[model samples]
Target chain A: MTLPPLLEQSVAFLLPYDFSPTVLLVCAGAALLYHRGWRRTRGGWGQALLFWLGLLGMYVVLQTQFDYYAQHSFFMHRLQHLVLHHVAPFLIAVSAPAAILGAGLPDRIHRHVVAPLRRNRLLGHLYAAIQEPLVAGAIFVGLIYFWLIPSVHFYAMLSVPLYNTMNWGMAIEGLLFWWMIFNLRAPGASDMRHYGYRLLVLFLVMFPQIALGAYIALSNHDLFGIYAACGRILPITPLIDQAIGGLLTWVPAAMMSVVGGLVLVYRWKRQSQQVEQPLSPTLGCAR
Target chain B: MPRFKRYLILCLLPLLLGCSEEPPGGWYGHDITGVMPDLEFNLVDHRGKAVTAEDYRGKIKLMFFGYTSCQHVCPVALSKLAAATRELGDQADQVEILFVAVDPKRDKKVLDEYVTNFTPDLVGLTGTQEQLKAVAKRYRVAFSYEKPRDNGFYIVNHSGAVFAFGPQGKTRLLIDDQSKTANITADLRRLIEQSSI
Candidate 1:
């Protein structure tokens, strides 16, 4: 069976460099749920496109040959985290797929599994605690710092379990943080009703990220030795690699906060508009 | 304390636990005990004999990845390992340096000579692409070849780490470029002493 060279190359690129069943299962499960739910709810075309793109983006970075470069290059690793922790999660959260996913769930399963789980006091309290704006903001930034500590980063890069944990943590935390920012529920019904508080968290988190990114980018020495320890895939100098990685951590990442703040402003405006138009039946029934 | 505060501390307990600085055994090298898997490989030795990690069982092994043609890092790292083993005196025999050649194609002819230049304790190992990939992935290390130059010479980049394993093949320490020969020797002595007991 001889395949065309281009097709073969594409296949190789799509194949996972280091396969993980967890990545496969989670991605496939999400896609399946979204597809089923989309048919039932007939969600907006734009939202569906965003959800699919976000899911595919996360899978591509985690499961494809891209992961091999991420393992070997400092810059590539930073890019992967940026996608996992910011861009892809941002798209997924902004799409607001929760209602559709819930609709996609089998009724019996939702009744017996999800409904009861949601009603669990401990789980509810835990969710509320994590959803607290200050707590969520702290964890969001804290994870980035914790994983970047040179010694911790060394082990995280070298150990497969730790590496998986780091990536998963970033993806999960990004989802939670971005979901808090983008959730469409009315201010009175939501955990953090004041958009002002979220705006503050976003603004506060950006400075620390900028400082950390700037520190790494401007540093003369190689802060992360793991890349050198494990040979880099690219032929670039260590300093160049570190610089590029630091810039990724610094620039686009902080820019995401600004973008998120803008989204918050828009939502805040829309909420006020809805409140003023309460007499309209459409506006009253929207929630 | 408030209930929410107590819950917040509970949620954060694991992160705090993970942040603890010191590795338990306190080896000079980065302690990787139980972090990486045991040594296991199928490769050909410098003398062209097919061997497995089992062939070197009961002896402490310090595995490193490099090609024979590596001009600087490989040579310097190999020499450092040689010197570290030499400083171990009579216990030198207990430590074997497995120099796994990532560029098997270019290294095949000169591999034996390359290892012998450093010390008798060094063993040059090369393997099939599948075999090499397995070993490299097992250690979370990587190697890649640069584009061939006009002269047909190309450079291969590889891990500069030296992974130390105990007699039973359990991974213990990772020695990087910054680790001095004395520190490596001290760790090797500790590794040997622990195995003997």
Candidate 2:
């Protein structure tokens, strides 16, 4: 199918790009609140920049050629997964969108939307459970392995219900997992212990991806059969395409995890050193 | 002088050998240099000799999925391949053309004479119905024979693309039919040179 020119397709850049009511409401509401929050919170341009960039990343992944060709190409699909499950989530978390957006919402919307959700004991417990390093890590690790299983992967491409659920599952789980990793506070524990736990979780997550990538890269057969008839644009064989996809998921994804962990360590060290002076207390609270 | 010669020799070795390395980026057909698909087969050739993928390991194999019975695509594709081989001239010995018959039932008896009609060197292979299906599945070659007519001759619709593998036993490329005969010949010649390296 011939696509409309990018100049003509410029209209899709608007949020709620897909007609799903939930995505529309959430994106629209977040934009309004984030705008207000940026102004009200005063002088947090860095945080605002990261948040907007995160949203832009999501829009590109969902609306651009990445989403269109991802169905037919393994490497492109890996790219979509990387943006949604890793990069966008990291940026979104670092921006602390929840706190800023909550503070910025109008009184009635806050009362009806944020207040009730905060008040729900069941949700509070569930959210608290997912925030734990072990639970969050296990759930995230499970999702990575579960989706890539050949039988599961093949059918997910064919079934709409399964496919949508998998996409949403990755987005939500990724956001939560990265958020919990960076925000490692637990009740009254020392920040050192918390940082240690975060570092460990980051290390643990890399193993599964490395193993999955090695298997795919090293395999001689066409593990993903869905692309058996498709891969001729670059005129690649199915096995070659899959190997490239495996490398994308394997090495770069692992490097990103390590980089995130290193940044946390550097920040933690800076905070610990600052604690010797008066400014240390506020530095720890900022992230 | 000895040190300079050693340095020059080390640098030139890779450029000369080119083995255990990738070909240059731009090529005529698909450039799948390292992917090894399931090309295993233990079938009798038209000449009644047992042949497998290993037997053709040292040469570039152009594998086609077609049969002789009800024929337009099969004949055309195979004939073009023969032309491509002739186009290779002196280097033609380095290529093996494999025609795997889709209809094993009727093709078992006629493959030799049929394949020779195009070129004597063109190897025709057929297996039992179960074995043929297994091979077809390996190459992702989907074909179904029509329910046999009263005359007992039915058309077998199959994937007609030709898959080329390098001498290193790695699946390399799918030659496009739209590619000119000379282009196809150049592709095969390149493949032969690439594997010999």
Q: Can you tell me which runs of candidate 1 are displaced by over 4 Å?
A: A184-193, A279-287, B1-25
Could you give me the TM-score of model 1 versus the true structure? Answer: 0.92
Q: Write the per-residue lDDT of candidate 2 for residues A200-253, one digit (tens) a residue.
A: 888998998888888888889878765543222234566788889899789987
CAPRI quality band, candidate 2:
incorrect
lDDT of 1 by residue, A239-278 (tens): 9999999999999999999999998888777767766797
Candidate 1, residues B23-74, lDDT tens digits: the string is: 4566778889999999999999999999999999999999999998889998
Against the true structure, what is each candidate's TM-score? 0.92, 0.57
Q: Lowest summed-lDDT stretch of 10 residues in model 1 chain A?
A: A278-287
lDDT of each prediction vs. the true structure? 0.89, 0.74
Instruction: Please tell me which predicted candidate would have the highest TM-score against the true structure.
Output: 1
Report the TM-score of chain B alone for all candidates.
0.86, 0.81
DockQ numbers for every candidate? 0.64, 0.02
